[model samples]
Target chain A: MAFRYPDGRKFEPKRNEMTKKSVNKDARFSNRGMTLEEDINETNEYYLAHQVAVIHKKPTPLQIVNVHYPSRSAAVVTEAYFQKPSTTDYNGVYKGRHIDFEAKETKNKLSFPFKNFHDHQVEHMKRVLDQGGIAFAILRFSYTDEVFLLEATHLIRFYEERDHTRKSMKKKDIEHFGYLIPLGFHPRIDYLKIVDKLITGS
Target chain B: MAFRYPDGRKFEPKRNEMTKKSVNKDARFSNRGMTLEEDINETNEYYLAHQVAVIHKKPTPLQIVNVHYPSRSAAVVTEAYFQKPSTTDYNGVYKGRHIDFEAKETKNKLSFPFKNFHDHQVEHMKRVLDQGGIAFAILRFSYTDEVFLLEATHLIRFYEERDHTRKSMKKKDIEHFGYLIPLGFHPRIDYLKIVDKLITGS
Candidate 1:
């Protein structure tokens, strides 16, 4: 199928067609073009390889319908549909603590919109927090290339207050409540350093 | 696409055509005929609803090759292949501990085969244990209706010693090293009670 952007624009899958100049531009901009999810995945891989943490991104849920098995080949899934995820995107163990979080990126410079997340995700995060797990969101302001580790409690409060307040969270509110995550080269996004501070207060 | 069992038997999709007597047999046996994976899933669901724990089975990974999108509804995956899982089947947070485990059942009354697991899964479990997460395997003896939570460390030892020792672990060794998980109605398998004992030793 033809891949489409959120705005309904057809997304060409030929990423290799991009010019070297654009690639250099991306490098110079500290990977401003890369998605937050990609950066987090790279970070998780680095962590796993280094024996620093055991974080992993959960596989995308798919409801398989029909599968065909050939005589001497791998089975092929012929019909399937994507299912809505019931839990957070990333989870693992860090210093014996259960770490759970979702990573999200938004182009909006003034505020982070609530539409980027679902109600079930928020509820799942709340349950994680209640169970003594460290639950949060890695929020990335794509336009500015700034990332923050916002605790689940803060997000939950804003989500519950949506009935009376604006649907989006202001940048000032995020700056006040969230901890800034320093970007790096090896791990790309060092959100765990922020987690360290959250755990040790050091 | 047609479904088939691992033994090369073509699976007819008409599950509803089963006789009532067979259904009665299934019900009377307390779902003993069901796969261990299915029982664990039901147990996980029960745990989630009762706020006992928040474990979940990760969806089977699929490598999508082709998809079809109609103008109005969700996109349907037209061609895909199941990818080998890199980690264990189940994981979640329980009482502030990161719980990670794989569940396997063997009809053999003598031993559980080591070939049922992959190398990457063992490596993943090792990482979990290194990070202080609770890592184990839920071994089910289908014939005896006995389930045991064998710690990952024990499994790793047996796995690494395969060159010198037997490729499979005897049931006697498992009975000595593993903690038996009691079967129940609400949670179905009370593995956490074993976990609590493992934690507190009380």
Candidate 2:
């Protein structure tokens, strides 16, 4: 359904309320039912609270076409169409370095498909990398319950070199070139630890 | 009336067409009839083309509620509402530095009101600054056709100290603390020049 709502005034004013009801129950309940997006958002919250970093997910872009104003105070979007994002989903700063990345979850057991990433996103990552910013991808294998932080350079390489026969990035190749993000309780996807390594090149 | 569409499929898929037709008639026509948003976008485009910087204005945030899939390939949002953004509008990397800011146009020539900035955006800017990113506000005085790049620290100082009957930052005060961004031909708002000075702290 492209993740839109059905009807009603569902304008959520969540500054810190996206996961306000979903978290702080217990550490064991970490990511029990949350999607990759939700988990990363929660992780970002934790980071913000601790002053660790300031990264944010860019909102889904929409080409708004129709609006119905019921009152002077509130505006309701009656019709809008999804637009292909020109860049990655997430970006921000950490320790004076620019951070940018895209998150994708795959149910496939052996590989992550190249179809998951758009060409412009790859190009955008390359540009970010060129500007001396940190660019990467967070790949989550749902079937195996594993996650890896792969640098954008490698992702771009796999993307550009993909042919009809090799439509997907192999799991082994991913593991070879990426760092397995440690699953944690507070921040579900602790990818910044890997990012720290990338920044210092340690 | 809140900048949503009126009717039809007005999905402008303009990766490069935002100012494609409006610009390049001549250098004298530079920002002759464009809005602040359009001008900044064109400037960012110029930056990208010149490999000068990689900056982007974040899309307006909305809480989409309902979507209809007319076909397997196309999904349309039939219901949604505007959500207050928790962060600033623009953020990116330039010269290996994390850059973040909010662009605002004021009709008032005497002062730029604190009302233009939301509480969350101010907090977000503060967080960005704390993370060692360069944060500022691009203030365009539409009445006078002048623009200024005001740093976050000074903006924050004015914001935090704002009180009853003194709800604005004066133009004189802004001129003292902010850099006057030059209006250019190719890039309508040449902000990175001031940013370069900021980076060197000269």
Candidate 3:
């Protein structure tokens, strides 16, 4: 049995790869060329090894339709599909506190679009908070290489406000309310620092 | 793209069917009359819906080697294999407490072979206990329709004593130390009662 995608596996080609990167008005904020998912995963690895926290990205659920048995020792997956919208992107325990969060990156320099947040995820975060869990999001302005930890309570407020207007969250709003985390090398994103501040106000 | 397997699809013969019932010494236990994996899954669902706990069975990690895109809506998994032994069978949160456990069912009426458990799982449970998390096992004596929630500390003691003339824990020994949870319709197995006892001894 194997735990990872078998070697030589290939992903489906990007559907809109032909479209060029959007040109933004702010010339100073060139989009950083790092995948948010990869960075967060690496940081989680560092956290686990250091015995700090144990956060993990939930596997993208797949519905397996058909499998074939070639030999007694192994079987091959014949078909599968993504399951559905997930409750949250990441979840685990941190110092006995239940930790849950989602990550989103936006290319827009001036605003973080509300569309990047999903309704169900918002609802799930609300429930987590109600259950006394620490819930939040890591919003990254890809254009500026900036990452901010926004409390779910604040995000819920923005989510509720979406009904009256279609406006995205202005960059200044997050700057004022969220904890701006400086990017680092070892734990790439030192999110626990923000978590400590959120829980302890330190 | 569909996230679920296509409707009305099935796997090969050998991979589909597993023994579902055990009978020994006038005691009979149903495998939930389903797969071991499915039972744990349903139990977790029962646990979550009742707000009694939040436990999840981690997806079995697999290595995918090939996928056939028969259509845009469906991706057929062509080759995959199970990975290495897992650390634990189930994990999640319960009343702000980190919960970790493994579920195992044995057919033998006289004794459950120690080999049913992996070394990694034992180690994982120990680690969780060291970190102040609750760790245990849902051991189903399939021959007797009995399930016990045995604390990891007790199990660890038994595990280490294996070389010192204790081959496997006797059924009576487990009954004396573990909490036998009568399966119910909702929350399936109410292990939390045992947890309450563990926490307060009341």
* lDDT, model 1, position A75: 70
lDDT of 2 by residue, A1-202 (tens): 1232233112222233222443445643645645677788989999999999999999877777666777555667787766677999899999999999999888899999987788889999999999989999999999877999999999999999999899999999999999999898888888999988987873
**How much is B179 displaced in model 3, in angstroms?**
1.1
Candidate 1 local lDDT, B61-112, one digit each (tens): 5666776776444566687666667899799999888999999888899899
Whole-model lDDT, candidate 1? 0.79
Residue-level lDDT of model 1, residues A48-146, one tens digit each, is: 999999998887766666667775445766876666678988999999999999988888998998876778889888878777889999999988889
**Worst-scoring 10-residue span by lDDT in model 3 chain B:** B14-23
**DockQ for all candidate structures vs. native:** 0.38, 0.37, 0.21
User: Compared with the real two-chain complex, what DockQ does model 1 have?
Assistant: 0.38
Backbone clashes counted, model 1 = 0
- For all candidates in order, the CA lDDT equals 0.79, 0.81, 0.68
What is the Å distance of residue B193 in model 2 from its true position? 0.3
Give each model's clash number: 0, 7, 15
Query: What docking class should model 2 receive?
Result: acceptable
For model 3, the stretches where C-alpha displacement exceeds 4 angstroms are A1-34, A113-118, A164-168, B1-40, B67-76, B85-87, B160-169
